[model samples]
Each structure stands twice: as C-alpha cells, then as structure tokens.
Target: MPQETTDEPGVTRPRITPLDIVRTLVLVVALATLGLWGFGSWTMPWNIVIGIGAPVVVLLVWALFLSPRPVLHVHPFLRALVELLIYVGVTLAWWSMGSAWAGIAFAVVAVTSGLLAGRRALT
Candidate 1:
C-alpha cells in the first residue's frame, strides 16, 4: 500500500517497500496465530470468546499506536516498544502451544522486520 509522506506541503504517496510488505505479512501471521492460540488453547465457550477477541484486541492496539497513521501519536520509541510487546506475546503464545522453534523463528523474523521498519520510520 502507498503511504502518504509529508515530505512537502502537499500529500505525497510513497511506493511501498519490501519491508512494508513483510511488516504487513507479519501482522497477518500474528493475528492468525493469536486466533489459533485462543481457540486451540481454550475450552468451548471461552474458546469462542478468545478466538475472536485476541485478534480484535491486537488490531485495536495496532490501529491506535502502530499503524502508519495511528490514532494515538506516541514517540517512535514507545511505538516500537508496543510493537515488540505484541511480538513477544505472540512468540510466547506459540511456545505455550509446544511450538518452541516456531516461536523463536517468528521472533527472529518479526524483530528483524520491526527494527528495519522502525529505523525507516525514525529517519
């Protein structure tokens, strides 16, 4: 997706980069994992609640603080911190479901992508 950058007085849309694609993929994977974790790890009724709720919560948090245009404009460091926390939560969720290697691998990719994206955001 093209993101609007305020390089000039007018709104200029910038071409999406590879990092942007990866970031979007990471987010999709994270939401899917959270949904699966909720359903797979819980009982019937609670599973229904959490399976839907987990992804919704993550989406809200991301929209508020981590999106290209966030509702809450925080410091870049704070934004990164929130992003890291979400990744950590997903990693731990994977580990809890007996997928230690998957969690670690996701952590590696997610953190690397986040760092690169954060660096670009800072610049």
Candidate 2:
C-alpha cells in the first residue's frame, strides 16, 4: 500500500486512491438519493416539511462537515462519524418504510464501505 509520508521520518497519512474516489462518489450519490427517498416517503405535514427541507438540510450538512472541503474543518474521524450517522439513518428510514429488503441491502453496502474506508485509514 502507498503511504503518504510526512517531513518527519515515520509519520504518514493514508494514501487516497482511485477506489477511494469512486467510493466517495458512490456515498455522495447514495446520500442524496436517501434524502430524497426519506422525505418523499413522509406523511402529511411531515411530507410538506421534509420533502422540501430534508434535501436542503442534508446537503448543507454534507457540504459543511462531511465533504472533502468541509467548511467546519473537522478531523477525519469526525467526518467519518458524520458519514456513518447519515448512512445508518438512511438505512433505518428505509426499514421504517417497510422496505426491509432495501434496508438490509443498503445497510450491508454502507457498512461494508465504511469498513473498507476504516481499514484504509488504519493502514
């Protein structure tokens, strides 16, 4: 694995790869889709509020704290935490809508992707 070495001899950063880029794009698209699906599935006033508000709120949050150029300038672990929270929340939202199969599939993908990212960070 390629390591991102620093000026100091032993310190290094996780080397970002093409696969990482692809994974990031996948997550971004998934999050956007989840936001749309979640809000669109709501009832009545919630539908009115969430249908319009959820996408805006989620995208704002993503741009602020989760994106590569986060406005908040958070730590990588913090970024990862936020990502996991959103992913799991979306999974639960699907499950709540009685889409058990979709929920399970999404959960599996999200978890597997997260683990892969974590492993790369550790390496």
Candidate 3:
C-alpha cells in the first residue's frame, strides 16, 4: 500500500508514488514534444510563436485544472478529462509531425500511466 504524509498541522496527503513520477514525466515529455513539433514543422516567425506558445498554453491549462493545487476546484472526473485531452492533443501533434511510432509509444505509456493515476484518485 501507499503511504501518507502530513503537509501541515492538520492536512494529510498521500505520499508521492511511482505512478505520480511517471505521470509527471509524461506531462513534461508531452510539453517538450509539443514545442519540438512546433519548431520542426513551421517557418521562422511561426515556429517561434508556436514553439513558445504551445507549451505555455498547455502549461496554463494544466495549472488551471490539473495541477496539484489547481486554480479552479473541479470534479476529479473533469480533471481527468482535461488531462486526457492534453495527452491526446500531444499524441496527435506527434503523429501530425510524421512520428507515428513515437506517437503510438507515447500514447501507450501515457494512457497506461493515466489510468493508474485515475484509479488511485478515484479510490
């Protein structure tokens, strides 16, 4: 079983798990992949716009709805939906950039990690 920790005098939180680490790595890779796709697939000015903008936008969305302490308080299911959408968008971006194998591999790992995380969250 996983362990728990006290973050404050009265607040108890679950300890970070292996799944949490995997999920965090997946998010970082997804953001990097988006930036790379933008930089590789566009011209000078447009590349600059997208390469910087894509990750920023994704990061903002994550902060708003998916961060450990999100800006918005939403249902866990809603949070999962948002997270899934980001993953799918990044996977599609990879495929659109002609990295079908990378996209497939990323999707497989992402979905698996997501499902495990979601299961933990739900329980």
Candidate 4:
C-alpha cells in the first residue's frame, strides 16, 4: 500500500520513518506502564529498571549518533518486540495483580500497534 502523508501543498511532507514509529511506541509504552504502575496495580521489582531504564538509555545513545529518515535499517517488529517485552515484563512483575484483563488489553494493543508499524516500515 502506498503510504499517504501530510504535505504542505507545494512542499513535500516529511515522510514518517521507522524511528517515528519507534518513538510513538516509546510514548505508548512509557505512558501505559506509568499508568499501570501509578495506579498501584502493577509493581515488578526489575520491570522499571529494565523497561523504563533501558529504553531511555538506548534512545539517548542512539540519538547521539543517528539521524532519522523514512527509511530505517532496523526492522519494525524488532523495535516493537523490545517494547512489548518491556511492558510484558512490567505486567508480569505484578504477580499479585488479581485481574488478568489489563495485561491482556495491553498485549493486544502492543501487538496490533507492532503489526501496523511493521507493515508501515516495510512500505
């Protein structure tokens, strides 16, 4: 499918990049995790250290050297998997969480987002 993008009429639109999807996923994961954790519903000892910490570190280091474009050498699924794992880890951390519904919801959303992004990146 041809990827439609926002344009400035006369000016070409800045094409969306794989990194943009990654960044979008980053925001989604960060917000979702925080919302879950903040609600006092999800608490995993190492989840924060891994999920939150690692992404920040990776993004910071990556930004120091990388420039973004519509074309990305990295695969979208890999990026999504990393994010999904982080959130999954966080969800798993809360062993005491009685309800299983929330985790399922998060998983569904993550996977759906990942697939959409992967397809977009490919095109």
Candidate 5:
C-alpha cells in the first residue's frame, strides 16, 4: 500500500490552499475594519470592536500559515489580480453594510495585498 499523501486542488482552483484562505481573509478584514469605524462613528459601544478585530486576527493567523516557507514562483499580474479581487470584494461587502469609514480601511487592505503579490502560485 502507498501512503496517501496529496495536496489540495489549490494548484489550479486558486482557493484550496492556506494562501488562498489568507487572501480571502485579507478582504474580510478590510470589510470588518470599515464596519468597525462605522459603528464607532455611530457612537456604538466599544464591545462592538470585536466584530471588526475578528477579521484582522484571522488574517494574521492565515497569513502566517500562507507565507510560502521555501517560496513558490507565481506570475506577477495574476498574483496581483487575485489579491486585488479578494481585497476589493471584502471591502465592498463592508461598504454595502454602510460603514462610514470602510473605504479608508479598504485602501489599507489593497496596499497589503499588493505587497503580498510577490508570492508565486504553486505550479
């Protein structure tokens, strides 16, 4: 019998690996940040901060897990696009929820995603 070692289909599907999860989480954090600001502007209680901080904490965990250990080589444009989409989607969701300062946080996520774009997709 052979050992059943296998990698997730993230190689092609672009959403099977920890990196993918981290990328998506980046976007979620952007949205959550916006929501947090919105809640704050509305004079909401400090307890509500958790709703926004949750995504950032999750993003950190996923990022630590997603950072390529030895490093993989992915195309620059494709990498940027994937990250951009994730970041935007998450921010947009937050904006839709009527976050007062969500757009500002969205910019931060966009910049972070761009910075992380140097990572290569697993071939």
Candidate 6:
C-alpha cells in the first residue's frame, strides 16, 4: 500500500516495512494475551464474558481508530492517543495478571518499536 507522511517524525516511512509488520503482529499478540488475562482475572461466568469481549473490543478499537485510514478517520493526535491507550492497556493487562517481567519486556519492545517506526517515518 502507498503511504503518506504527516508532519510528525517517522510518519513518512514506506507503507509497511518488515519491522512495522512484526511490530503490528506483536501488538496483536499482546491484545490476544490481554484477552486471556482478562478472562483469567475474573470469576467463572465473568471470565467467559471477559475472554470473549476483551480481544474483540481491542480489535475493534484498533480497526476503528488506530489503523491507517480507519473507518473513523480521526486526527493524527487522536489516532496516536488511541494507539497509546491500546499499548498501555495491554501492558497493564499483563502486569495485572501478575506477570511483571512480561509486562516490562513488552513495554520495552513496544516503546522501542514505536520509536524506531517513528524515526523511520521521519526519513
């Protein structure tokens, strides 16, 4: 897909690089794991609901707000905010599940990938 850059740094990279694709895939995994965390965090009946709902909600939010040219077509700042929310949400979800190391590791990777991706956009 063709790409257009915004005034922000790293917004101008090619439509998708290998790193970008991998980062995106990893984010999806975080979302999925977050769903599992949600499921396990709750009681029986609620766990079932959370397991099914959490990932679906995250996926929809990503598609609607974070994805490029999403259906909502939000402003760049708003898009970035939504993306941050997702990233933080997943990170916290992991932490809340008593996986501090996993949370920290994912946060480091997510932040690094985000910075690198943004830097790539700037070039």
Off by over 4 Å in 2: 1-25, 32-39, 121-123
Candidate closer to the true structure by lDDT (higher is better), 1 or 2: 1
Worst 10 residues of 5 by lDDT: 64-73
Across 1-123, the per-residue lDDT of candidate 4 in tens digits comes to 998877557876577777577656655564555544444542576655554664465455334322244234455555555556655654553333554676676666656765665676579
For all predictions, the C-alpha RMSD in Å is 5.3, 7.5, 5.3, 8.4, 11.3, 8.1
In model 5, the clashing pairs are 73-120, 74-120
Mind giving the per-residue lDDT tens digits that candidate 5 earns over 8-83?
7656533466645655665565656645544544445543665556456545633544344414435556545555
* TM-scores vs. true structure, each candidate: 0.89, 0.65, 0.86, 0.47, 0.37, 0.76
Off by over 4 Å in 3: 1-14
Candidate 2 residue-pair clash tally = 0
Error of 6 at 106 (Å): 0.9
- Model 6 earns a TM-score of 0.76
Candidate 4 to truth, TM: 0.47
The 10-residue segment with the lowest total lDDT in model 6? 113-122
Best by lDDT: 1
lDDT for each candidate structure? 0.94, 0.72, 0.91, 0.55, 0.54, 0.78
Give the Å shift of residue 42 in candidate 5.
22
After the best TM-score superposition of candidate 6, give how far the Cα of residue 67 lies from its true spot, in angstroms: 1.6
lDDT (Cα, tens digit) per residue for candidate 3, span 1-123: 988954678777678888889989998999999999889989999999999999999999999998878999899889889988998999999999999999999999998998887787789
**lDDT score for residue 96 of model 6:** 90
RMSD of 6: 8.1
Q: Can you write out model 6's per-residue Cα lDDT over 59-108, one digit (the tens) per residue?
A: 89878976655789866667667777777888888889889888888878
Stretches of candidate 5 off by over 4 Å are: 1-73, 116-123
